[model samples]
Target chain A: MAFKTSVQKYTGSINKLEFGSGENSKALGGENVLPFYTFDGNIGGKPLIGLEILDVYPEKWLDELQQIYGDAANNAVQWARFVEEKFSPDFICLRLEGADPNGLNKSPEEAAALAKEVAQAIKVPLVVAGTQNHDKDTKLFEKVAEVLEGCNVILLSAVEDNYKKIGAAGVLAYRHKVAAESSVDINLAKQLNILLNQLGVKNEDIVMNVGCAAVGYGFEYVASTMDRIRLAALGQNDKSLQMPIITPVSFDTWSVKESVASVEDAPEWGSQVERGIAMEVSTAASVIAAGANAVILRHPGSAETVRKLADALINN
Target chain B: MERFMIIGERIHCISPVIRKAFAERDAAPILQRAKEQIDAGAAYLDLNIGPAERDGEEVMMWAVQLLQNEFNNIPLCLDTANKKAIEAGIKVYNRDRGKPIINSADAGPRIDMLDLAAANDAMVIALCAKEGIPRDTEERLTYCTEMLERGMALGIDPNDILFDPLFLVVKGMQEKAPEVMETIRLISEMGLKTNAGLSNVSNGAPKHVRPIIDSVFAAMAIQCGLTAAIVNPCDQRLMETIKTCDMIKGNILYADSYLEL
Candidate 1:
């Protein structure tokens, strides 16, 4: 039973990142092993839960979610503050859904103003997201990144198609960071990391979004994929892909009708609030197992569930 | 025993004159393969002087020193059936990196090598195959457990004793692939790392199919929680497959934008 004990040395060359200044920034980084593996190393910190604050209410959101934050849905500043006071999230993720190509199509400058306004309102770290459109995301992120200088926020979703522009802006304009996203497939996950590094973004400046899926869907696939990423970084020491991962748990959970729909949809499904909490917790736990460094969530109740679980998983 | 490791295998030992080369201290061919293997990503050079086992100690000592001298204190795996040779090589081995590994030990009478390795403070590779290769996961795991107990009795740390599941060549027993992968998974689940002679999976296969089979097997083994392997890192396709596999598995983080599928 005496297993050989040795320090798990990462095989790849890694570039480190500094998040917040002084004690707060040092708070991030340094997970040498996969999440929740107490036998290996210290899993000191919980995955930071950043609440999503859209400049405008997502019109398509389920009614149940709308009821919770309906008052601040129309105002970005109020929404940011509401998320902070109501949920006490570790960070504020501001998604500029209004700048979609077919939506309001707000210019980057306008989006930047809203982003700055949100950042000033919240004491927590900020995550700036743009419309899913590749071209628009690149352009819109640039302005927001610039106006939010010294905020030490996290930029969102720099996909392969438009990474150069987005990466350049995040590094040069914002003192913030970026997240590299890929489809469920693992190869795409790696290729995207190489592309981001080539763009001159250091490893610490980038977070990986392995593309989260809700529980009982493609979530396991995401979990296994993320687990593989952490193993390669911790065990094999492959530096090109060594970065903390971001899992947008709320978006994945909220999108699933089982989370918010009534019992009438499926009497066996049980309470909507309970189901939402269960789904979010399961999704976050799965990703954490795969070594997610941060997770963005919705439902105030679900966020609290994940935070408590993270404490046990990471700290214990 | 100290748990320093030497990941060794026979795939890259490209010399029919390997024993003679080491015996004569003919640095040319030995140096060539050593440099190639290490540069191709070998962490330790496995010096297996089979067939010519009489001067095991002499040849092993010379080759180990020759490899370390030229390769900047590189560690070695003194691979052979000859016990005296293992002792000879270790006597001269510089203790900076690690004690020379006694290529392997196992259950059955082969288990004696476990005590030999322990007495010498050297690490050893423990194959789950004692008399012969186990045909199923249960048998393989049983052999692993027995060997682990035997090693622990000799005061050898399990980490120092790498469990080799004996990578079976798919061309001969394709059905056993899953069984072998399952064994790897079980070992990893125990939080113990395993190493396989990765090149063994492709043995007897067609030339072009070698790298493909090896890389795919390496990927699958990795998925099963394998920590390392004995393979040529210079194989571009295989290396690329490993690199890409690492990313997909999330073992390594995605670079700036490259990991985007």
Candidate 2:
């Protein structure tokens, strides 16, 4: 018997969601088969790679990242423009770490203004990531949603704790997409998506960040959770979990010991930059295989490598 | 509120190993397959002795007694074309675990299987098809109603008569997938139990892709209110999918080790 490949009959597909408007707009999802299972069905689009740029000057960044951004790290608009020009990422994810109440406690207006500036400075789609502080993110995202209203940027998250305010103001009212964030649990992921849907957020206007953990840092939870979510979405025809997944790989991977430990702390780990890139690439590849439609990465080298991996797997 | 039932399909007479085991009355192969399935959380084991024409009664009786004795009276689904074999197996069945299931009957010539089930006081899998595959859901439901009425007339409990939608192979019947799900839903709406030979959906699929197709179909069917299925419980991915869907549907309580269940 000449080996005949078994093609799957997928009854459900991930919703193809477009985030940015006009020529810069990009979409993810719409694949009927599992991620990178192109032999069975269409991949729809290559998994998108978004370069992460912070709203405030990153003070705690490792020297490896500092070298790449240089003076552009000092301003959100400059950083967004620099990353866009230098790397040409699928999108720019602007993390509003400055607005956290425990940190700089920058006002929502200040953050929203920066968001608008970055949205204008960048040609690709913009993903505005909040501080993850429920009370503060709700306020900051509401303001950013208003400022970037017609720009059609994606609000990085509308979590279970504050889905009402963000789902209404940032998504339904402002006509922007929202990433529904959930912890590393499939049930919680489905519940949040359900809540967002009930709040009238259309499936196309939503994506999932089912949570991420750096490789070897309880990463199995992230992998298994994502696998379950994808199976539920494509296999079970689960509409609630049908939105594409966008994992913030950089946020979790960059903070782990494997990526951040210095030469003095661990001389055997090789160059700090290589270690960080390896961590980022490893985590990105794992999540992509486990079914992340898009991933936000920090290092430019890591982003480029992952983009190549995705292109090779999906485009070929 | 009904939990999904997984009837293990591992002990069939198709495999050369199992065929040899059956011919020689070798307990090792059959018992090994049974133990593996039971440990993997199969609710029941389907013992398929195909045809069993010559020594049908003797084979069915011995196999049932051997399995029940060794596995503490494990519930079983007697599967064979020979009606006498099924009857012989039921005579020795231990009903304390669960009522023995008569492998099947359709609305056509085999409709008497329901009468046999009622006479033996056993459950039966009623396929919602009469002559080959039904033209559509209407035909499926028509057969469903006909068999349902027949079973009811024989005083068989509706729950005991698990209506099968006859899962067709997806490779050639891809468009009929939704129709199968709709039939399950309509059958469910009638407030009756439903089951399927889930592996049928992935029959011609490649080995690696079979589990994915089967598991996905299982979830879709469960969402449509399917109550049970005859499946290969040893397929880890398929079992995980079933457990996850059960937890999502609230049929099973969630826990850190829900998959282990």
Candidate 3:
């Protein structure tokens, strides 16, 4: 009667993916063990934080976030540099928010030029995300890929509907890593990796982004999705689900009402800053424990806190 | 592709050619065997330079250096009863390719090999045996748990400690073969990776039937969650069988030319 060792060995590992190029490049994922369990297997690279920027100033952001950046938040280049010098993010993610057809309706050329400028302005890697509009992402990513040819950036995403076009563009033109997005479904996530691979995107170049959310906003659904995806990749050794995970925590968590509500509005919840940072960090920590390799965050303070936890988990 | 590892067993001291080469310190035959296994897609190169009662350390060092130099620094599994020989082999092991593997530790007398593994930060193949091979699956599991707790207490990464259920020769113990598979299934359910010396199941059988039994057992063991194995990768049919099994099991990404992977 010994202490029954619950140690599990994985047959497969989360693939290691490198983004950007040269000295500033960042590699993510590549763990053979469950997240934060360095006692089990190599933790691969440290969990990375990609600070989110927008092509256009967000119209709906809380005043607190807007005040945090002031004039710097209005321009992509300054924001990228600001975050690079201030927070030292692993990568700067540019969401082509204005390119959304329902938003500013900025043309692909406008977004592409803005992307090149921001990519050039920062030392860290660039993650040029799209507006979630399938048609728009297809066009925008193609132009961005062409403009940033051989730059080795991480193309924001390709949903199942438009993965072929964007994934091909990413591989053929720029040699970029394309994040394959899934709708909180493990099969869809695995299927998307397969489809992307079929398009000649090397499995090493595909990142699994299965849609990140806040604590109350289907966190369990997304967290379970991540756990199942990891179990499939490592436990069942499913190659289709072996891509590294990229969870954009701030995209969903920061926009939640709990993160933005004023203290007067929700006095019991305490300061919005604390509530917001806690929401983003806790969401990231939970997902990281569930095997997320990358966390796309917005707030610099929260990014530092989450990354500290990640470093402790990795080095401990 | 997220494929499991295949450690080639052809370079062990028990093999006649390997033993002859070890006696003469000839690198030619050993290198040739190593090439055959590498060509057939063996991820790990197991080198057993005999029990280094006297010159085992030198033999291990020479073999490790020769194998690495010839194979562009391939990862090696140092298989020897002599702990010092394992240490000697590890002294020259290249870390760039992969981690060095300590051939074995058992829950019985060799449980202290866990200390060697921890000290060197090397992976180990832990056999589930107390006095001899276990009489039943429960007995095997008890030994496995004993080794696991011991390894973990020393802060050894659980993933690095692979389990061996002790594959029995199928010629005499036909009924026991299925139980090995069952033990593997039970171990897999516990979330541990399992390994077996593939040739052991068909040892002393007719040469033609050996590969057949080995391949069949390999596929069956894979189905039961055996993630690592020591086999003669030079067996094209057996290699292809395991490769196809991996593909069908969704362990490896399918491609038009997956056979090359």
Candidate 4:
């Protein structure tokens, strides 16, 4: 009698969350196996890279980042077109940072115009990120969702405090997706997903942002929690966690001290450009290995490197 | 209730398909039913070869071997009145996954099953009754102690001794309904695991009302400290309610995907 090796039994398959209407539309989270464990089960989708674009120009962006897109860095549409023409990312994530209370404090309508201009300039799907300001994000996302109706945009977040507002704007009014967020807590992540589902948003249309940290700062916690979420969904058939797992690496990585430290400040750490790219790519790799279906990364070079790595891992 | 002890009750010999399958030794229907229950998150299967008297020994051994071969040492509860049949099943039972459970021992003359369980290193569900169901929590505890002490004296491990305050039909015992919950609470308060043949609570009721009543009672029973249940795993509503109750009580970790799990 031939006894095969003991294999993990998975009862649930990830819900493939697709965006955009036709060609070049991308999807993730349809795998039956743990990330890249193809010997056990099928990987329904490969991890895709979404390059980050900003609606607000931060006054102190790193020299390396500014050097790559000099004048394009000042305008949302020009910056988006530059990234598309250069990196050709799978998608574009436009962070509405100007809406933040501490930032330029742009109006919701102003941010919506910037989103529309960027989305129109790019062929790929747009991921409209909020300012992490609940009230402002609700109004800002609603305007963006309304303006970018048929573009199949993904609202960057709908949190526990205001899932009904943002979730409604994306799913109820516009034919789009919502990124449901929770603080590094997986229970809260599942709770947010439940709240969104209760609002009539289909499970496949929601992406879970269970919180992401930089490579040096509690990276293992983010990865392990994401893996646990996937196991609960695919292994234990958790319907609330079955949606695609997404992480925002750009904002967290760029702000970390290690990524910003200059070579003269720490020459042993390597070139500042390479160090920043390493920070972004390393975090992306960790989240992908931990079962991220989609991730938003900042640098063009980091996105290129991570996309190549994703292809290799999926094919393995 | 950090994790529920769900005893799949679908293998009862009373079911027409099971009866026919057991008679013909057809593994198809038996395997199908077992797989369905396992997929539905049943922890153990209660193989109730109902009233298998004459050939009980042979049929019991056959099922124990058949199920073990197919499911790779899946824990089983040898549920039958025939002590000899339970012994026969335990003889070939695989202990890799878990030890077998003797369907029951009672405070009545059937108390000898406790000896069978002790010798076989198996768990046994002890019913709190000598002849008929106990009238109240005090009377129930009296019989429960009798069985508990008997098993303890026989060298049976305390954790291996499970208690069942027999659930009576709610349709007829409407006045006695709260007694079962009280008995379960008292048993649980003593740090002993409590179980019940839960479907009995809906017996004689209309088919459509059975599931609703069983689920509602299950939620109430969990609140009263019931640890395990002999349930129809295929009963979607009943199972969903059991999982939901576990979440609300903060016993089992709550996940939105709980229903799927």
State candidate 4's DockQ.
0.17
Q: Write the per-residue lDDT of candidate 2 for residues A177-288, one digit (tens) a residue.
A: 9999988988778778777877888878899999999899999999989987887677766677889999999999878888778888999888887888899999999999
- Tell me the deviation in Å of residue A312 in model 3: 3.1
Q: Over the full model, what C-alpha lDDT does candidate 2 score relative to the true structure?
A: 0.90
Best by lDDT: 2
TM-score (chain A only) for the predictions, listed in order: 0.89, 0.98, 0.94, 0.95
- Flag regions of model 2 displaced more than 4 Å: B1-261
How do the residues A1-316 of candidate 1 rate in per-residue lDDT, one tens digit apiece?
8988776544332234555433444234466665766666655455678777788876876567788888788798998888888888887788888888898888889888988888787777777877889988988888877888887777788898988888888875565788888877666777777777767777678877878899899677887887777666666566656777778887778768877677887789888777877888888877877777788877777778778887765555
| TM-scores vs. true structure, each candidate | 0.59, 0.61, 0.60, 0.64
Error of 1 at B254 (Å): 13
Cα lDDT tens digits, model 4, B1-261, are 345679999998899999988888898999999999998989899998887888899999999999989997889999999989999999999998778998888999789999999998999999988877776878989998998888999998877888998888999888778998898898888888888899999998999999999999988988889988999988999999988887787544576665765
- Summarize candidate 4's per-residue lDDT along A79-153 as a digit string, tens digits: 999998899888889999888878788988888988998988988888889999898888888888988889898
Q: Judged by TM-score, which candidate is best? A: 4
For model 3, how does the per-residue alpha-carbon lDDT over A1-316 read when each residue is reduced to its tens digit?
A: 8887577788779888988879889998888887777767787888888888898775676677778778898898897888889888889899999999998999999999999998888889988888889999999999999898867888878997888889888775578889989888776777777778777788988888988779888889988888878877787667778889888888888878988788999999988888888899899888888878888987888898988887876666
Model 1, position A229, has a per-residue lDDT of: 72
What CAPRI class is candidate 4? incorrect
Report how far residue B230 has shifted in candidate 4, in Å.
7.0
Query: Candidates' DockQ values?
Result: 0.19, 0.04, 0.09, 0.17
Sorted by TM-score (best first), the order is: 4, 2, 3, 1
Clash pairs detected, candidate 3? B52-B56
